[model samples]
Target: MPETTRILLVEDHPLIRAGCRRLLAQRRNFDLQEADRGLAALELNKRHRPDILLLDLDLPDGNGLDLMPQLVADNAPVRIIILSMYGDSGRVSRALAKGAKGYVTKNDDPAAILTAIDKVLEGEVYLGQTVAQALALTQLQPETPGLAELGEREKAILDGLGDGKSLAEIAADLGVTYKTVANAAGLLKSKLRIRTSAALVKFAVERKSA
Candidate 1:
């Protein structure tokens, strides 16, 4: 039999962690361990050198999506599988762009979680279908930064919005298609919780001033 796979799970919710622990326990190949935050997970990495890390993007102290590069900065190599409540492409893409090995939405079938882990452990990049298609579109099309987390593209979008450019105008200026810009705006509206372009503009202006 293959050796037990040491797994490090980082999540803030106790009930969720307990459920995950139970699920992994049922899989004979895994040896489950748990932590509550990105910092704690990194510490455990230093001591345990786990084979796989099941990371939750949202945490009490910080975000796992932002922690991927740091997790890989050292000489040690660890596979990261992001588990998040967010099913949006922007959020999933952000995690993958930061070097995470896999991404799974909480709403996906439970088997998807296991599948993501297995794929990463086997050294394959994994993104759920919805996330994968989103990334594909992100690469093939032009998009606005409204829904994306704090990233370079997001900053550019904010700057443009703050400067009072319409999505069509911005898309034209940016050399991307109009629909892509519209989609990005839609994402931005949902992510930023703004119902109108005016609100988005206001939010951007305030954010820049702050």
Candidate 2:
């Protein structure tokens, strides 16, 4: 960490940002900046070159996962800690694979955020309690056949299925054709090695519940 750690927090929710701002205020030698969207995050990151980035996975303009490569490339050696509501193994693993040094869920004890920042700054990876448990359970289970191979759209379709949405409804919500969603669902089944649509739906529900 530098003499004054420059931290950029990217989150759309004002209340959440304010809570984090208050929590982070307790730390000495910290300079904090905030951005609510991916575009603004990119701009601020370019200008400030923060030492640490507290990133939220969902942004109004784009998924934060999609923004990770650019941020990592632009800010070499800058540590990233993901602060998300999702504690699921899939999202956690994806975030880590994309270069996040730590994962902390919003529902975790606020201290977990500070702990993650400290640990990552010291060149250690940190997982909040809930995220650690989820990943441990995933490791213990029989791994899903091709879960890691699913692309963003496939994952989105699976999420839609988990929410009990029909294929047509998912297509409309995603602003894609119904056929597109149907094909993606078929691909999802193939990737997950599910024998039937009903089984796929069950898997999606189970994943969401996790």
Candidate 3:
């Protein structure tokens, strides 16, 4: 590790950013910076070359998941930890698959954030308690046929469906067009072996509650 563990915190919410700043302040060796948007994050990552990135999935300009590739392209020695409001298995899986070294939800005990930083710095992947349990449950459950083959976007759409969101609402939330979400939902029906949109929604709801 560098003499000072430089960290860039990317979050749009001011209170959350302040809380993170205070928490990280407990560590005498930490050097922290903040960014409220994806573009700013990329610029800061380029200039600061932080050792760790505490990123939020929701940003003002774009989805944090979509921004990961640009940050990774910086070729810095930064390890990313997602500090998200979402603790669902699909989001966690997608974050890790995108090269996040740690996954910590906002609802998790605040101390878990500090612990995640320590673990990632020590070269280990870290998952918050809730995230771990969610992933474990997802693995243990008998998934519907073809569910495992769904891509990240498909899984996200399914999650939105489970949350009782319409395709238009999901499109807005995901920063995509309504047609895109509709097409994905149609594809989801075929993949999950469901014949109708209403049946697909039922399956998603049941699976989410399971």
Candidate 4:
């Protein structure tokens, strides 16, 4: 007899939570708990120490991304699979970067949730089909300059920017002059066809994480 997999379902909607509960009921190897908010999820996580966390990205008290690090820390041996409504690559990348083992949107087949759980439990990273397809399409789409089109220096500059470093700081870290870093930033913005520094920064951050 296999040991039961303890699962904590952290979702804000009562109806959705109930539906998940009903679905999990068919799996004899799973023991499920529930939380409708981030704070409550944290409390239950600390108390129950579940083996797998099926988390929703939007919670009443806070965003699920904010809670992922804490839950991941508290449950080191456990797996976290994000069950969210958002399928955007940036969100998926951030959640995975923050230590989530899987990403699945609400729009995915219901069976995908179970599949994600199983894959993550086995230490694999799982992305829902829709999310994966969207990422693929986004990557294939034409642009002034995609991530793959960047040069080594530009890549390094973008990495530094992504880390929220100042231009001078990046220059110091890279052992280059401030002017050199600034020039690189300008080229990056031009090549990416982005109009503002804020957009460049956001792009770098999202791309680096992705």
Tens-digit lDDT string for candidate 1 (52-93): 888998898887866777677641578888888765655665
Largest TM-score belongs to which candidate? Answer: 3
Candidate 3 residues 143-192, lDDT tens each?
68999899989988998999799999999989999999999999999988
Give per-model TM-scores.
0.67, 0.80, 0.81, 0.71
RMSD of each: 9.8, 3.4, 3.6, 6.2
Task: Indicate the worst ten consecutive residues by lDDT in candidate 4.
Answer: 138-147
| lDDT of model 4 at position 197 | 89
lDDT of 2 by residue, 46-124 (tens): 8899999999998999999889999988888788999999999878877899989999999899999999999999999
Return the clash pairs for model 1, or none. Answer: 146-188, 147-188
TM-score of model 3 relative to the true fold?
Answer: 0.81
Q: Candidate 3 vs. truth: CA RMSD? A: 3.6
TM-score for candidate 2, residues paired by index: 0.80
1 against 4, candidate with superior lDDT: 4
The CA lDDT at 92 in model 1 is 69
Q: Which stretches of candidate 1 lie over 4 Å from their true place?
A: 133-210
What is the C-alpha local distance difference test score of candidate 4? Answer: 0.86
Local distance difference test values of all predictions, in order: 0.76, 0.92, 0.91, 0.86
Q: Which stretches of candidate 4 lie over 4 Å from their true place?
A: 142-192, 195-210
Q: For model 4, name the residue pairs that clash.
A: none
